[model samples]
Structures are given as structure tokens and as C-alpha cells.
Target: MTRLPVLRTPRLTLRGWTFADTAAALDVYGHAEVARWLSPEMTRVPTPSAMRLLITRWIAECVGLPPPAGRWAIERDEDKRVVGGAVLLRLPPGHEDLEIGWQLHPDVWGNGYASEATYALAGWAFSHDVDEIFAVVRPDNARAAATVRRNGMLWVGETRKYFDLDLEIYRLRSADLKLGAQTSQRPPGHGNDD
Candidate 1:
């Protein structure tokens, strides 16, 4: 069996999905608000058996993949709760690019968890030789788009073919990532950690 690696940030844990996280996974997907941005096929409340299978598949994929690509369970360090997921998918065929995506519990909205985790993951990807990272957020998801921007990604306009819905594309390069690093190192009280 392959083991999934764990990634940590100051406030979050990005790790492989485990059986223990199935309930939280289901809770995240089962919520209408949380599922709004996901594929329609996965919008329903997942059965425990189905969630287990999904988690198993995710663990297998992570173990077999290299950096710049894989799914992760987003856990909150304060409460140690599995809140959601983050993914860095290797772009398809002609693109030879990388795409970053994430979803968090609705309750955590407004917190900077998503942006913090995204910046850390993007840094990790850069270390693996990924030159660029992009994110496609639905036009209606203004909050997510803002998070992408706050992380130093520039809005590159829209793409119709990227998802089931029209999406606004945002991009960040390894060079642009230096800004995030500097911002992250600021003394406490200078800015919110989230």
C-alpha cells in the first residue's frame, strides 16, 4: 500500500484523505452552498460507502503522483477538523500547465484558510519545477476570485471550455510567488494570519 504524504502550514494541515475524514467529506459535499461550485454530478449528499470509496481513490492517486498534482484533505489546526479539500491538477494534453483548486467548509468562509493553504501549495509546486499555476473560479464566486487575487494571482480573464460553467481564470508564476513569501513573513499583528 502507498502512503500519502502530509503538508503543513502554520494553521492548516493538508494531508491524504482517511476513513476518519469520510464524515467531514460528506458534510462538505452535502451542503448545497459548498457544492455549488463543484461538478453537478457530485452535488448530492454522498453515502458513507460512497465517501469511503472516494477517499480511498484519492489516497491511491496521491501516493502514485508527483508534485504539481494531487488532492488533499484540508484540516484546521485549531480544532483538527477535516474542513475540505485542495487540488493541484496537472493540466491536460496541450496545456502542459498546472491548475489549483480548493473548497472549504462554508462555516470557514471569510477566514483566510483557503488563501494560506493555496499559497503554501503553490510554493510547494514551484519547488517541484512547476512554472505556472492557474485557478478557474466561477464568475459568481466572487469571494474565491478575491482569494486568488489576494494570493498574488492576476486575473487572466475568462474561459468557457475550462469547466461546466464559464470560469474566470487567474494565474501566478514562480516569480509572482515571491510576493506571497514576503507577505507571509510579516510580523504578527501586521496582518491577519488567515
Candidate 2:
């Protein structure tokens, strides 16, 4: 089994999904608001049983996936709640580009969990020798676009290359990640670690 590294930030832990996380995972993937943005790649998870199966597949699939290219549950440290999901996977077709993405339960939308996860995932990918990571956001997904921008992902125009959807592509190099860390403010309630 490929053991995913546990990545930590001030307020979140980006770690592998476990069977115990199935219900919390459902709270994130079962909602249409979160699922809609994931269409074509993933459909809304309908039932607890289905979600359990999906989690099983995810856990099984991790063994074969390359390092740093897998999914994680975005768990908040304060209450240890699984607030969202994060991914660093290869884009489709050519499979040469890496895509960084996050999906939060709508209830936790403004807490900056996604932004923190993005940086944590990107830094982890960089440590694995990946050069640049991209985030493909639907033009209508203003919130996601803002998160990527906040993480120092540069706008690189639109593409229909990945999920067969028109998406605005944002690129982030290792240097850009450093710059973003130097300038971006932590979300309220997030501290520099007392």
C-alpha cells in the first residue's frame, strides 16, 4: 500500500482518506453544490453505500498511483472534521500536467481550508520533484478561481484539454508558491502556530 504523507498547516491536515471518514466524505461529495463543479470527472455521490464503495476504490487505487498523485481528506484541526477533499493528479489525455484541486463542504467555504490545502499539496508535490502544478477552474467558479489566485497560481488562459469542459487554467511553480506564502495573509482563526 502507498502510504500518503500527512501534511499539516496551521489549521488543517491534508491526509489520506480512511473508512471512518466515509460519512464526512459524504457530507462533502454528496452535495450537489460541491459535486456540480466536479462533473464529467465525478458525479454526485448518492448514498452512503455508494460512498463506501467509492472510498474503497480510492483506497485500493492508491497503491498503484504515483507518489503525490492521490486524493486526501481536508480535515480541520480544531474539531477534527473532514471539511473537504484535495487532489494532486495528472490531467487527462496527454497526462503530462499535474492538476491541484480542492472541494470544501459549502458550510466551510469561507474558512480558507481550500487555500491552505492547495499550498500544502503543492509543496508536497514539489518535494516529490514535480515542477509546476495547474488548477483548472470553470469560468463561472469565481470562488475557486480566487482561491487558486490567492495561492499564487498564474492565469494561463483557458483550455478544453482536461475534463472536456471550458476551464480557466492557472499555473503555479515552486517559486510562485514561495512568493504567495510571503505575501498572503492567513485566514481569520488561523495563526502562525502559538
**lDDT against the true structure, each candidate:** 0.77, 0.86
* TM-score of candidate 1 relative to the true fold: 0.86
Candidate 2 lDDT over 59-132, as tens digits, reads: 78777789889989889999999998898888898989998988889888777677688889998999998989
* Best model per TM-score: 2
Candidate 2 RMSD to the correct structure: 3.0
For every candidate, C-alpha RMSD to the true structure in Å: 3.0, 3.0
Off by over 4 Å in 2: 189-194
Per-residue lDDT tens digits for candidate 1, residues 1-194, read 44545779888999877889999998887678788888533556558888888888878878777765788899999999988899887654445668888888888766777777887788778888777899887888877776777777888988775544677888999877777666555443344323
Q: How many residue pairs clash in each candidate?
A: 1, 0
Worst 10 residues of 2 by lDDT: 185-194
Model 1, backbone clash pairs (residues 3+ apart or across chains), number: 1
Estimated TM-score for each candidate: 0.86, 0.94
